[model samples]
Target: MTLIPRGFTLIEMVIVLVIIGVLAVFAMPDLSVAAIRGQIKESGPLLDVAKQGVVQGYGALGKFPANNIEAGIPEPTKMVGKYVTRVDVKDGAVNITWGNSVNGSIKDKVLTLRPAYVDGQPAVPITWVCAAAPVPKGMVLTGVDATDMLAKYVPLECQARAATAP
Candidate 1:
């Protein structure tokens, strides 16, 4: 009695593998960016909480915290679950270091924020300005890189740097 074959042929298996490989090659970059974006989203609320803390401190004490610790934020030595690795406050600026979950293009980037001072007060409520750099006089980060996740993910308060003169 002859038994009928029930398994795929070697060529069929090879074709399936090649198809999967091609699909993976195309899907990988998007998946990576999406994963990083998810992580960044998670950090957003936490950052807001920290910012609120600073505002609250200012309201109660009549000044921004001298540092993160004073603001009740602990300085991070490493990333906490694909989010911020560090939080720092100085000279009215808040700086956050990105975690490893971010893509290499912007991983470990330091985002700087400062409460906009309108008439010597921190705006009517609070308006944060995203500094392009760490310095107080740095330009705002705005529509800088269309492909840069860091620039894309930045909050609305920030503006991309202006194009340089040729």
Candidate 2:
């Protein structure tokens, strides 16, 4: 009886492995972008929660929070495993900077939240800025305008704050 080859040859196996490696290299960039997008989406909601806390604290004390410590929310907390290094309220806005160690470098992102009135209604706009390395060249960080971005996401109570503000 004649013996027949039952599996791929050594060369065929090497070629298959090489193809997989090439495909992985091409796919890695897409995966990274997807991850960043997810992070960006998550950031908006967290800022909303924190902003609500700020408004609540302000309503109770008759002033905006002096700092994240006084904002009535946990500080230095992790959002999706990334450390939120700082949050500050300034000029009727909240600024949040967060970072995480990735591949030996600290990747950081900044978000700015502002209270504004839209369509005769109050709203909060949150802008995201990424300062991490390996970012695309000439990638502008200017966030969307406060009025445009926050019109849909702002909470009802936060919207009232703008109306009540002198």
The collision pairs in model 2 are none
Highest lDDT, which number?
1
Which parts of model 1 have CA positions greater than 4 angstroms off?
Answer: 1-38, 120-123, 133-157, 160-166
Candidate 2: lDDT of 158?
33
TM-score of each: 0.55, 0.48
As a whole number from 0 to 100, the lDDT of residue 38 in candidate 1 is: 64
lDDT of each: 0.58, 0.47
Off by over 4 Å in 2: 1-5, 37-46, 54-82, 100-106, 119-166
Q: What C-alpha lDDT, on a 0 to 100 scale, does residue 11 get in candidate 2? A: 98
Model 2 is weakest, by summed lDDT over 10 consecutive residues, at 126-135
Model 1 local distance difference test score: 0.58
- Measured with C-alpha atoms, the lDDT of residue 40 in candidate 1 is 60
Candidate 2 residue-wise lDDT, 18-38, digit = tens: 999999999986666555445
